[model samples]
Target: MIISSAEIDSAVVALAPVMRRTPVVASRVLSEQLSADVWLKCENLQRTGSFKPRGAYLRISRLDDEQRSRGVVAASAGNHAQGVAWSATQLGIASRVYMPVGASIPKISATRSYGAEVILQGETVDEALTAAHAHAEESGAVLIHPFDHPDIVAGQATVGTEIIEQVPDVDAIVVPLGGGGLLAGIAAAAAVHRPDTRVIGVQAAGAAAWPGSLQAGEPTPVGTMDTMADGIAVARPGAVPFAHVSELVDDVVTVSEEAISTALLLMVERAKLVVEPAGAAAVAAVMSGQVDVSGRVCVVLSGGNIDPLLLTHVTTHGLSAAGRYLTVTATISDSPGGLMEFLALLRDLGASVVDVTHSRVAGSLRLGEVQVTVSAETRGPDHQSEVREALAQAGFLRS
Candidate 1:
């Protein structure tokens, strides 16, 4: 189904009072790094901690009275589950949400908190979706897909309308792509209102299907996906959204896992924004130079509903990627003060020790020799190198 700008405008008007008008701010750090005017559409601050609510609410609101009475069912990794649950509650309708078993704990709890029946099934979203479909068919509930539907696309297009109004001269807009509803909606809106604005879609390298699908001239499912950006780890693009993307979107690119974590870290430290790995995909593309940012660019931070444990892991990985965190296991004498001497060397090299462990019974160690494992926070790659060099000079060989 073709969703026009008028439909999006109507969705904007219908959702005006329901949804928050998420802010757009200039990213001075990103601007300087990319040598372009960089802006961030902070959808991470949107209701339900994502832009998903806009689409979710709109789709549910359009349902007939019977459908509303029958309730709604949805499948999601996290953000969409929360959105659907929140929307159903707001509309005074029952909701059943099917989420992947590995979905974030916070999201699952949040969805249940919103008064939805949360069912954890399958290891991936595709599997969860299958379960959701079966439930909908059995229970006579209206299945509200995360993407694919025309109403969902029209609702998501509201973001583009807001962007056009906020950034009148936006030369390029970068968005993270999952099943492609958000990208398709924004691109369609841009095609109508700001034809000159380049609409770019970003996907995690591990889960990217658009590049191959586009090349094949059809929607193609990936056999395997391995990425921390679970929000965008869709195996295939939705048929409805793919039609819009093929015609309206300017380009699609993929970013590495390292880049996604780095972008997430940068947002926390530099922008003071809590963004999920999937939400940071556009920024990751910019940081990795995978997208053209040589113009007035706006990168959408799609959601912030990340689990605390995952956030910790991503932050640590990001620090390691930036060369600001180092872990080394070195051979040291089992004699007293051996561990202390190794720590002293690290301190002298200006590396702050975060953790230290000594193992005397390691197979790699000789008699009276122990292995000292140390994790430290350094300034950067250079500081890490200096610390390693200092350790080597102190007769400590890294294992």
Candidate 2:
């Protein structure tokens, strides 16, 4: 069935009572820098920490009494699994979620905690999907696909509806693409109502299948995927999504892992918003200059379920990029005040020492030379250079 703006609007209305009307926050810094009115749809704060819950709950709610009694099954890498499990549990229906073995621990635990039977299967989403289908067939359960169903597409379109209502004059909507449920939904609504408003889709450079698919005018799968943005790491787009994306999406671009990391960190530090890598892909595209969005832009922050360890790494990566953290080695004289002198120089240069490592390793330094590896936090790159120059002028050459 052809999913139109009316169907999307109806789905949004249907989901109004169940799903949260996620807020849209303006980005002052990004807007000033990009010379545009930038707004961010904070779907990351939605139920299950992602907008997937909207579509999942909407689709599950549409099932008949008999279908609901039979239960539902779905395969997902992470966010979608949690959405299905949580939605099913809320509806008092049995649910089974098949997730890849390497899926994040938090997602696995969250799915199980939501009163769903969680199955760890295969190495990829496709493999898990195959297993989920087999289980559904054998157990007489309905398979709720993550992105390939009509209900799902219509349900996800609610995001578009919310965006337009939240920011009526939005000139462009940049969405992250995985299997394209979200993108297709947004495109369908924007194409008809806000025809003048451009809709751009972004994909991780590590898994850039959309560009190739657009060129070929068909769905094309990437042989391999490697990126931190697992949410948009689909090897190819869905059939329905491919059609809409090819026709409605104005431009499809790709962003690198570094850009995604920076975007995540910036959201946390600058915007005070916690966003996962997948959810930050749209911002990644604009921040990395992969796309030119100079006018009013709305970026969809899809999810915020990043692993703690990865979040820590992204934060440090951001600090490094901003030159707020510096790691350097210096050779010092083996004297009583040598360490004090080195530290004094750093203090004089206005650098706050974060970590210091001193050693007398053989090849790295002479017997009487002390190798000091100092990590300091500075204001910016200029302050970092000032610290480096101070160490150099104090007869403590960089080791």
Candidate 3:
């Protein structure tokens, strides 16, 4: 279905009372780094910790009395589930949500707390969605498909309206792309209001489907999906969003896992924003030199409902990727003070030790030698080099 300017305008008015006009804040750190004035559309602070609720509410609100009476059913790994559940509750409609068996406990709990009857049904989101469709058919409930309908797209367009209003001179807008509702919706608003403004879509390289689909002139599905950024790890592009994206979007780009982690790290450390990996995708594009354009750029921070465990893991990975964390192994004399002296060398080089392990009886160790492994924190790539140089010069680092 075609999503027009009028439809989006109507949705903006309808959603204003229900949805947040999330902040568009200037990022001084990002501005100093990239050759552009950068602003973040912090939808991570939106209701339900993402932009999902905006579309969910609009889609549910459009249902007729008969459809509303039948209630609604949905499937999601996390953010979308909470969004649909919260939207349904706001409208006083009964809702059921099917989530993957391995979906994060926090997300499942959040979905349930939003008043959804949570069902653990399958091993993956696709499988859970199959169960949701079955439930919808059997129970006569409305299926709230994430990002596939005009209402969802129009609902997501409200973000675009906010952007145009917030950053009137924005040269480009970057969005995290999954099913493409948010990207297409923003592109729609940009098309109608600021035709000169560029709208770029960023996807996880491991699970990207847009470049191929755009080339094929239709929605295309990928054979396999793998990514830590669960929010935008969509294997297929939705048909409805594809219609608008193929025509309106300026460019679609993919960023690597390392880039995403680093971007998330930067957002947390530099901008002080708790953004998920998917939400950091656009920033990853800028940091990794994937997005070539520059001006008053606005990167949409899509969601923030990350599991604490994941946050810990991703933070470590991010630090490592950014050269702020390091792991090294070396052979030292098997004497009692050997390990302590080795650690002293690291301390002298300004590396803060995280953990250290020593073994005297390794297969590769010489009779009077010990194998020692250490993980340390550094300032950046240069500091890492300095530490390695000092270790090697001291004859403590072997090959």
Candidate 4:
């Protein structure tokens, strides 16, 4: 089933009333660093805080009268669940979504708020999908797959079509990939309108399935996936998306956990964009230099539906990864002046203390001696090393 530009064009026309024409913004910092024109496709600002609704809404809207009456069901890491639920509500059809047991709290809540019966099941999206399939079979609800359907792909392809229209001179597009709906859709659009425009897929290193699947020339399933970017943690490549991606996508690459966190931090600090880890994956790829890119490159920020707690953790991790945060242990005297002197040392080193813990009874501590653990904020990597070196020289550093 070839998904032609005509189908995508029709999807664009059909979805115009519902979907936002997301913006394309230039990344000054990234352009300066990479020495190329870098742009960001802010799909993170799309309805439901993601690009999922494009596919989900289009897929659900296409169902016949009987299917609509019976309702829709789906499984997602988080974003797609909300998309389907919101779309179902808009169409006045019932909806149910199954999300992984540890899915982001905000995403789950948003899905329910969109009027879906939410069930928390399984440890991964693939496992949740199993339950969704069973529900569709037993309850007769039409299964609205997160990907893996012609209509879904066609819907997502609107993003690509928009990208071409938004950046007529774009040289490359980097996308966050899970089951490949977004990547494949964009690749198809590029193939039709701008064949020479490179389409790259970025995946969380722990959950990447495309590299293996593309090598095999078929949809391939992996045994396990572990990543903080739960939104892109799928175990297998969907067959429908695989066909388009395998044939059309220029490259598929993975980004490390640290790199993803760093990218998320950069987006928050530099771009003022609140994006989930999966949403930052493409930027991670670019920042980590995993994918060779130059010229006018654009990366899609796919979603922004992240739990606040997760955002805190990712930001802290990103700080650590970027060497802007540090934790150090030092043995100080179990005396009043001990903490004051130790803090003074940190102040002199220009490290702003974030937190401090003093322990009197820790492993092998002498009777008069105490242990102090300090977490500090620093300027950058070199400053972190300088702080450590200063502490070590003062004979307070442990190790």
Candidate 5:
């Protein structure tokens, strides 16, 4: 079914009272870095820490009493489940969410807190979806898809409405793509309101389908998924979203794991906003030089429900990418004097030791030799080089 501007506008109007009109934040750092006017659509701060609530609420509110009484069931990796659960609770409807066993703890807990019966099943979203669909059929529960629905596309289009009003004369918009609900909806609205503005979709490099699928003139599943952006890690694009995206989206770009992690860190440290790897993929494309932006650009921060453990790793990875964190292994004499010398060398190079481990029996170290693996905080990449040089001068072999 085709999604029109009127339907999208009505959805926005319907959701106005329930969903937040999240902030459009200007980032000087990102603007200077990208050499373009940069404003972030911070939907990461939306009601369910995601823009999913807009579509979920709009979809749920439209259900008739009979359908609502039957309740709703959905499958999700995390964010969509929370969106559906929260929207159902707001509508006073019974809801059950099927999520992958590997879903983040924060998302699982949050969905349960929203008053939805949570069911953990399978290892991946596709598996959970299979189980959810079967359960829905058996229990007569309404199945609410995470994406690929007309109401959902219409609901997601509201984001474009807000963006046009919030950032007039926007030259381009970059959205992270999964099943393409958000991209399709935004593209449709942008085509109507800002036809000249370029709309680009960003996907995880490991899970990208837009480029190949558009070329093939049909949905084509990726061979494998490898990136950290689980939210956009769809093997294949949705039929409904793909139809709109093929026409309205200008370009589709892919970003790497490193770029996504860096973007997430930048959101937290530089922009003071928390964004998940999936939500930060658009920014990742820009930061990784995968996309060119010469004019005013808006990057949508789609969600912010990253696992705490993953957040720690992303922070370290990002810092390492920016040359702010350094890890090195040095082999020295097994004697206690070797550690003293290594510490002195690091201090001389102005490296602050964050973590250090010494092993004498793990490998082929000589009877008097030791392996010291050290993680240090450095001023920059130059300081890291200085530390390496100092260690070498102190008779420590780089491992």
Candidate 6:
């Protein structure tokens, strides 16, 4: 099933009224940092808070009357669940979504809000897929795969069409790869409209399966999948989308967990955009210097369906990774005003104390000494170093 430009055009027409024509905006900060013309395709702002609906809606729309009557079942980590649920509701079809037990709370609630029966099963998407398949078999419902289908790929190809229309001279397009539907779709469309535009795919390093699978010329599954970018934590690439990716995608790359977290923070702090970890993979690749961004590059911010709790963690991790947050343990006098003096030193050094813990009965503490653990916020690495130096010079021994 070759996905052609015409098919993508039809998808665009089909989804025009439903899907948001997400904007393409220039990233001044990224452009200056990478020395490239950086543009962001903000599908993070898309309906259902991700680009999944483009494919989900189109796939469901193509279903025959009998299939629609029987309804549809799907498995996803989060975004796809909401997409399927929302699309199914719009089409007046009953939908059941099997989500990983560890799926984000917000996503689970959002899926149910869309009027789908949400079942929490398994720890990963693959496990949930097993349960979804069983449900489809038992209930005689049509299974709507998150990826792995020609229709899904064709629907996702509409994103590529929009990119070309928005940035005609685009030199490259970077997309986050899960089961490869988005990458395959964009690559295929680029082949027709902008053949010279390089199509790059990014994946979380912990759960990346594409590099190994591409090497073996087959869908190879990773032994263990773990990453904050749950949206792209697929252990294996979809067979159908992999075929398209193998032929059309120019390159595939992986970013570290740290990079993913830092990228999410950068998007929020710098771009003022709330993006999920998986949705920040393209930007992460660029920020980590894993990809060549020397030309007119467009990074797809795929989704914005992150839980608040995860966002807080990512923000803290990002700050620590950037050297703006510091933690240190030191010995101070157990006498009253001893702690005050130490805090005064930190204040004089221009560091804001975030947390403090003191213990006088620790094994390492002397009779008149106390162990103090301080968590402080600094301006950056240089400021953190200054604070550490001040402590050392003030006769405060770091433990």
lDDT of each: 0.94, 0.88, 0.92, 0.92, 0.89, 0.93
Report the C-alpha lDDT of model 3 over 1-399, residue by residue, as the tens digit: 768889999999999999999999999888888868999999999999999999999999999999999999998889999999999999999999999898889999999999999999987777888899999999999999888989999999999999999999999999999989999899999998999999999999999999999999998888788889888877788999999999899999999999999999999998999988899999999889888647799999999988999999999999999999999999999887988899998988899999988887889888999898899999999999999989999998878
Please give, for residues 1-399, the per-residue lDDT of candidate 5 as tens digits. 568778977988899999899889898989999889999999999998999998898899999999999999999999999999999999999999999898898999999999999999987777898899999999999999888898999889999989999998999999999989999999988988899989999999888877899999988887777778888888788899988998889999998887888888889998999889999999998888887788999999999999989999989998888787988888888775778888888887888889999888867677888888999889888888887877777678644
**TM per model?**
0.98, 0.93, 0.98, 0.98, 0.97, 0.97
Model 1: runs farther than 4 Å from truth?
none
Q: List the residue pairs that clash in candidate 1.
A: none
In the range 143-169, model 2's lDDT, one tens digit per residue, is 999998888888888899889889999
| Top lDDT prediction, candidate number | 1
Model 1, 29-130: lDDT tens digits are 999988999999999999999999999999999999988999999999999999999999999999999999988889999999998999999999999999
Candidate 4 local lDDT, 98-133, one digit each (tens): 998988888888999999999999988888999999
**Lowest summed lDDT window (length 10), candidate 4:** 217-226
Candidate 4 displacement at residue 125 in angstroms: 1.0
lDDT of 6 at 347: 92
**Higher-lDDT candidate of 2 and 6:** 6
- Report how far off residue 4 is in candidate 3 (Å): 0.8
Model 2 steric clash pairs: none
Query: Ten-residue segment with the worst summed lDDT in candidate 5?
Result: 390-399
User: What is candidate 4's local distance difference test score?
Assistant: 0.92
For candidate 3, give the lDDT of residue 164: 96
